[model samples]
Target chain A: MKKTNAGKKYAIFFCQQIDKNQDVNRRSIEKEFGPQIRFFPIPCSGRIEPLHLMRAIESGADKVYVVTCPEGACRYREGNIRARKRLLYTQNLIEEIGLERGMLELIRLKAGNNYTVDKLTRELLG
Target chain B: MAHKYHILTSPTPARFKPITKAGIIAWEEGCLKCARCVKKDCVYKVYEKRSLDSRQMLDSLDTACMDCFRCVQNCPNRLIQKSINPLYKALGDNYWTPEIIENIWNQAENGRVPVSGGGYHGPFSGPGFDAMWTDMSEIVRPTRDGIHGREYISTTVDLGRKLMSLEFDSGGKLISSPPPLVEIPLPVIFDVLPWSPGGKGINLAFLEAARNTRTFAVIHQADFMTDMDEYVPNIILFADDDVLKLSKEMIRRLKIIELPDSGNVMAIQEHLKKINPALVIFIRFRLSRNASVRAAALAKEGAEVIHLTANENGMGKAEDPLFIKDRIRQIHSHLIEAGLRDEVTLIGSGGVAMAEHVAKLVICGADAVAVDIPLLVAMECRVCRRCTEGISCPVDLENIDYAWGASRIRNLISGWHNQLLEVMGAMGIREIRRMRGEMGRAMFFEELEKEIFSGMGIKGLINGK
Candidate 1:
C-alpha cells in the first residue's frame, strides 16, 4: 500500500507487554509508512507522563497515539488506566494553551488479540 | 615536577534543552503561504531543526532562535512576534535572578568568559555583592595580561593554620613544628548545595569535577562513600558531630575536615589532629550578630579555619542581619585587631553568585569562598525545587551521566577562573593572596556614598532604601 497521509506526522507510544507481536508488526509498518511514523516502546503505559505526550505534539506531530494493554488486563494492574487519565490531562492542557483538541488519543489493545498495532494504525489513518 | 596552575575546560553541552529568554510566536492563520516563507529563509534554520526536548519539554526553536528578528520583520502578514518566556522569568528567585542563571548556563556550556555583546548596560549598582566595585584602573595595561599566561598570577590559596611567630634554637635552626596546610589552585571550592535533586550521580559529579580542577569538594561525613576513596585527598569531609565516622586511615588520607562549632569543637579538632597531625580542620559556624567576636575567639582558641556561613542571600543568620561582605569585613578586622588574621584562614560562603562575587568577598576579608548554587545551575538545574516537594525533577538530574555533569561543573569553574584572572590582571594584582582583604582597591557603595554624597542626603539612597 502507498502512504496517503502527506506531510502528516504521527507518533505511537506503546507498552512492551501490550503487543507481543510488535517486532513483526513494527517491521511491516516501517516498510509501509517509513519515516512518517515513529514508535516508542516503553516498559509500561503508566510511565507515560504528560511531558512525553505534550513533547510529541510540540515536536510537530499532528497526532499522538498511545497504545496500552486492555483495561484491567495490564500486567502492572493500572497502567492503561493511568495512561488514559494522563492523556485526558494532556488534551485539556493543549486546549488551554490554544491548541486543537483530539491531538492525543489513548488506544487499548483488544484482549488476546494479535496484530492490534496493524489494526489500529490502519483504522486510524485509513 | 609540578606544573603551573591552570584549569582545563572543554565545551560541555547541556543534556536538556535550556529555557531561552524569548520565544517566537508565529501564526499560520494569516500566512500568505509565500513561495519562500520567511521561516525557511532564516539564517539560523531554527524552524527547520525545530524539535522538543522530552526531558525539559522545551522547544528547540525558542533556544535556537538568535533573536535576529528576521522572521518577525519578514513575515508578510505581521503574524510573527517575540515575547519574553514565562518559563525563563520563573527560572530562579530574586537572589538568583534569571540573568545570573542564564550567565551560569552559558559559562557551563562553553568554558569562556561571558561577554555581553553590548558593553555593560546593567544598573549602576544594586544589593550586597553588586554594591561593591573592584578597582580596574590598570585594565588598559597590556603587559599585565594574566589570562594569556604572559604573567604568572597565582590563584592558589592555603586552607590551614599558620604560625604567628616561629622560634629558633641556637644557630638559627627552626624548632617549631609548623602546622600542615593544603593549597588549592582555585580560590573556589565546591560546597554542599543548599538544596538539590540529589543522587549518587550528582554527588559523584561534584567529586569528579573537584578532582579534575584540583580543588576540594566539601562532602558531608554521612555522604562519604567507599567508592569515593580515590578522591579522598580532594574531599573536605564535613564531620558534623560525626567525627567518629572517619577512620584513622580515612582521616590520614583526607587533606581537610570541617567540624561544626559545637561546645567541644576544639577537643574534637585536637583529637583529629592527633590521628593525623598533618590534617587541616575547618571550624564551621553560622554568621550571627557577634560573629566577629566569635571568630576572633575561635582563632585564638587554635581553630585552623573559620568557615562563617551566611544565608543563601548573603544575609547573616540573626534577627537584624548584615550582608556577608559586611560580616566578612567585621570578622576579618576583628582577627586583625587580635593579631590572629594571619594565623587562621577564614572561608566565607553563601550568596556567592558569580566570579566577581568571589573577588569581592575576598576583598571584604575571606581567604577563599565555598560555592554551592552555581554548581547546580551548571548541571542544568533551574532551581525549581520540585524535588524538595517530592516531585520528579523536570531536568531528570538524578539520571544524568556523571561525566557530562562533571564536565559542565569543570567548564563553569574554568570560566570563573579566567574571569578571576582577568579581574586580577586589571587590578594590577599578580596573586590572589595579595588581593585578599585589599579593601583599598575596592570602592564600597556605602563608603563612597557616605564620602562624596553624604552632605547631599544620599545615605539611604545608596542601597535605594
Candidate 2:
C-alpha cells in the first residue's frame, strides 16, 4: 500500500513489551518517510503522562499515536487500560483548546498479530 | 507543649496534565486555511501553540484553550464547538466525588487552602456532613484570623486516659503519677487505607507524612518494615496476632500500640502494657449497631484509648447503618452518661474525606479523626478501586516515589489543619479540644427543620391532610 502523505508529521509512542523483539525497526520507516515520523519507545504505555503527549504536539507533531498491548494483555496488567483513559483525557483536553480530536490516537495491539512497526506507522500515518 | 502547631509545606506539582473540565472540537478536513484563519486569530494563541504530549498522547490545546469560543464564532465553516470532557466527569465515585478529588489534588500540589474564588455555590444542606452547618457567627469578629493570624489557634490534641480527680500525699512532693499520654500537633492521623495497591513505598509515605506533621499513622504489624525504625515515634503499630511476637525493644520503641477488640481485649492491653508500661494501648473496634454500647463498656473497663472505625463511607455495618456522626454522638453521649467520657480518648475513623469533616467529627464527639482516602486522593488516586481488583493502579501507586508521596500527603494534611483552624476560629474557640462535642456550635438540618416546620401544618399536608 502507498505510504501516508509525505508532508504530514506523526509521532508514535509504543510500549517496549508489545513486540517480542527489542528492535522497533525505526530506520526503515524513516528511510521511506524521510523524518516525517518519529518513534518513542516507552517501558509501558502507562508511563505515558498527559504532559508528554501535550509536549509532543507543542514540538510540532501533527499527530501522536500510542501503541500498546491489548486490554488485559499488558505484562504490567492495566498499563494499557490506564493509557487508554489518559489518551481520552488528553484528547478531551486538546479538543477543548480548539484543536482537532483526531490528532491523538491509541492503538491496542492484539497478541500474535504479526504486525510490524513499519506497518503500524504507515497505518497511523494514513 | 506550647499550643502553636505549624505544618511545614511546599509546592508539589502534578506529574501529568490534569484532565480539564471542558474540551473544544474543531473540524480540520474542511478548513479553508485562510491567511486570517480563526485558529491563528485566537487571543490565547491556543491553536498556534497546539502540541501533542507524545508520551501521554495528550494535546496541549485542551489545557491551553481559554474557552473563549472566539474560534467557534469566527470559523467560516462553523466547525468549532466546545463541551464538557466526559473523562473529567467520570473521575471518582458517589462518595469520593470528582470535585472533592480535584480539590484534594489542588491542595496537595500547591499546599494551599482551596478557595472556591466565588461565594459558596453549593446547596444549603444535604446528607451526611453536609446536613450540618457550623456556626461561623464569629466571622464578623475582627479577631478572626484563623490560619495566618497573629493570635494562635491550637489544634493540639492529647491521647490516652486522664484521671478525673487527683490526690496528693501529706508531703508536698508526693502525688499520683499521671497516665502516659501522647499529644499530636494536629487533630488528624493517617489511618489504614480501606484498599490500596500495597507496597513499602506507600507505607513509608504515610509514616513520613505522619512524622512530618507530628501525627500518628496506624500501620499493620505485618506491613511494618525494620527500615522504618527512624519513624518509630510516629508509628502506631496495629497488632492483630503479632503482639506476642514483637520484641521488647520494638514494643518499647513504639509510643502507642493498637490491639483488636476481642473477648480478651483488656488482657491483651494488660499484657502489652506490662511489656512496655510507657505504651498507650488503643482498642480498635469496628463501628456496628452496638458500637456505642461497646465503646461505653470499653471506657468503663479502663481502656486508655478507643479507636472506632466505620465503613469507607462512614456508615456502621448493620442492616440500617447509622452515619459516622450519629454513631460518634451515640458513643460520646453513652460515655458521658457512664461518666467515662473524660477518662478515655476516642479516635474516630472512616468517612473523614475533607478538612471540614475533621471539625464536624470533632463536634460530633470524637477527640480526633483518622483519615484514609483523602491521603490517597492527595497522591492522585481516582478512587477507581482497580487496585482492589488486583489490577495495576492507573497512577502507578505501587511504585510511587516515597518522597513525592509523603510531600503530597503532608500538603493535604496541612490544608486540612488550616481548615480546622478556620472552623475553630470562626466558632470563637481557640483550641480544638474545646470544639469536641460542642453540638451547640453546629446546627443539624433534622433538628432545625423539625423545629421550624413541624407545627406549621406542613406535616399534616404531607400526610394527605
Candidate 3:
C-alpha cells in the first residue's frame, strides 16, 4: 500500500482500552495534535489483525497508526504482543510484495509517558 | 533477596495530578428501592451500599464518581446522572490520570482471551498502533500444553554477558568475574507501561506473578518507597539521574535504574561515580540504528545494559516487518563487531508480539523482550483504530472490574507461556538462557531472500519471511 497525497492521505491514531484515567493523556495527545488526526480506541491491541491493517490501507488511509500502551503494559499483556507480530508479518509481507512498508506503524505510548506529542506527530505526518 | 526495585529508585519528580472532593452521595426524599444499583457490585466501590435519597445522590456524584460509569452500566432504572469530574480533569496537564490507567485495567480483565470462540466487533484498523501487525504462521499444530509439552516449560532468560574468553592463571586455574549480572525467570516483564492499574490489588498481581515466576518488573518508586519497599526483590525502576531525586536510603534500595539515552554517557558515568552502587546502570534508547552505535560505545565504556525500543508496540524504525528484524540483527551484529557484544545486556521492546517472535528476537540477540499491545489485545481490545478518532474503546476501562481485569491478564500470560515453551521444545533448548543472542539456531528473512530470491520472486515474496 502507498500513501501519496497529504490531503487525501488520512492518518489516524488507534488506541485501545482508554477510559477516564487515560483522558489525561488522551487530552494531552489531543491538545498537542488538534483535529488533524482521528482517534479509534479498541478493547485491546491483541484484537487487531493483519486483515485490519490491510483493510485500513485499502480503506483510503494514507497511513494508519496504533498507539498501544508501553511494552508489557497491555491490559491483556499479550494484546500488544499479538498486534506486534501481526504488524511485523505485514511489514515483511510489504517487503516481499515490493510495496512501501511505511504505511503502517505501531507505537507503545503509556498513560504517563513524558515524550512530547509534537515529536510523535512530526514522525507520523512524515 | 535484594530486589531490582532497590537498585533503581529515584525521588519522584514533580507531576500534575487531578483530584476532586465532591461527593456522589444522595440524601433522603425520593426512594424507589431499586434492587439493582449500578454501584452495587462495582469494583471501585465509589458508592455506599446503603440506599441513597435523590437529593443525596445528586449532591454526591460530583466528587465520588470517578466517571468510571459502573453505575451507568448497571443502573436498572438509569436514574443516576453522571459527568466527568472536572476536579479530576485538572490533575493532568496532558494525559496522565488514574482513570486512563483504570480503563486499561478493565480491558485487561475481560473481553480479551475469550474462551477460544468469540465475536470481534470493531474497525479493521483506524489509527495509531492498530495499523501495525505481527506475523505468526509457523505453528500449524496445536496441543493444550502449548508447544507439545508434556511437563513444564520455562521462560527465564539470562541478563548478563557470557565469557568471550576466560583468562587462566599460570597454575591453569580459570579465573572468572562474578558473571556480571543476574537472571530472571521470565522472557519479559510488565515493565513500566504508560498506564497502570489502580489500588494494591493489581500491583500485587504483578508482584506475585513475578515472584512466583522469579521474573523482573519495572515499577514506580512510589509503588514501594517504604511500605512495599520490602518486596523490591525484582523491580527495575527509572532513576538513572544524578543523586536520584529520591532520598539516599531509597536510592540505596534500588538495583537497576533506567535512564533515557539522551546520548549523554558522561551523565551516566557521573551518576555512577557518585552513588557507586553495584547495581547496573541501564540506558533506555530509541530503536534506531544510531542508538546501536551508542550502545556499542556504552558497552565499550563499561555500561552494563542497553534498553532499546520502537515506541510501545514496536512500530516505526523500519516499517518492513522483515526489515525490523534486520535492523535488530544489524544492531546485534554491530555490537558484536565492537568486541563488547558479550559484555552489554540488550533488552529490546516494541514489535515483540508473539511466542515465535520472542524466540526469533532472542536468536536475533536480545536478552529479553518487552510487549505493549499484546497485553491490551489479551484484555479483549479490538483495534478499532477509531480510538484516537471519535473516542471508541468498547469495554470502556474507566469503570473496570479490578479482580476480573487481573484474571484476564493471568489468562493471557498462561496462553503466551504455553506458546513460549512450545518454541523452546521445538528448538530443543532445555534452558531459556541458552537461547539468548543465539542467532545461529533460527532463520531470518534475508537468508530466505538469498535462498530463493530469483526463481520464484512472486511466490517467494508471499512466503518471504
lDDT tens digits, residue span B66-140, model 3 = 556666566655545443333334332222233333333333343222232347544553222233232333455
Best prediction by DockQ: 2
After superposing candidate 1, which stretches have Cα over 4 Å from the reference?
A1-126, B35-41, B54-57, B138-142, B454-465
TM-score of 3: 0.49
Instruction: Report the CAPRI category for model 3.
Output: incorrect
Question: In order, what lDDT does every prediction score?
Answer: 0.82, 0.81, 0.53
* Candidate 1: residue B82 lDDT (0-100): 76
Off by over 4 Å in 3: A1-126, B1-154, B161-163, B167-176, B195-205, B220-230, B240-243, B263-277, B316-324, B376-406, B437-453, B456-465
- Which pairs clash (backbone N, Cα, C closer than 3 Å) in model 1? none
Candidate 2: residue B271 lDDT (0-100) = 84
Stretches > 4 Å off in candidate 2: A1-126, B1-3, B27-50, B61-78, B138-142, B453-465
lDDT of 1 at A74: 76
Tell me, by lDDT, which candidate is best: 1
Which DockQ value does candidate 2 get? 0.09
In TM-score terms, which candidate is top? 1
Per-candidate interface DockQ score:
0.06, 0.09, 0.02
Worst 10 residues of 3 chain B by lDDT: B6-15
What's the best-to-worst order under DockQ?
Answer: 2, 1, 3
lDDT of 1 by residue, B1-465 (tens): 235777788899987778788866434334677723334668988877776567343457888888988877777777666767655776778899889999999999998998868688778899899899899774455456567766677888998899988999998999998999989898888998888877888889999999999999999888888898888878999997478867898888888999999889999999998998989999999998899888888998999999989878888786636899998998898889889999999999998989999999999899999999899899999876656655556578989888899999999999999899888888888779999999999998988878776556555575434
Task: Assess candidate 1 and give its lDDT.
Answer: 0.82
Please tell me which model should have the higher DockQ, number 2 or number 3.
2
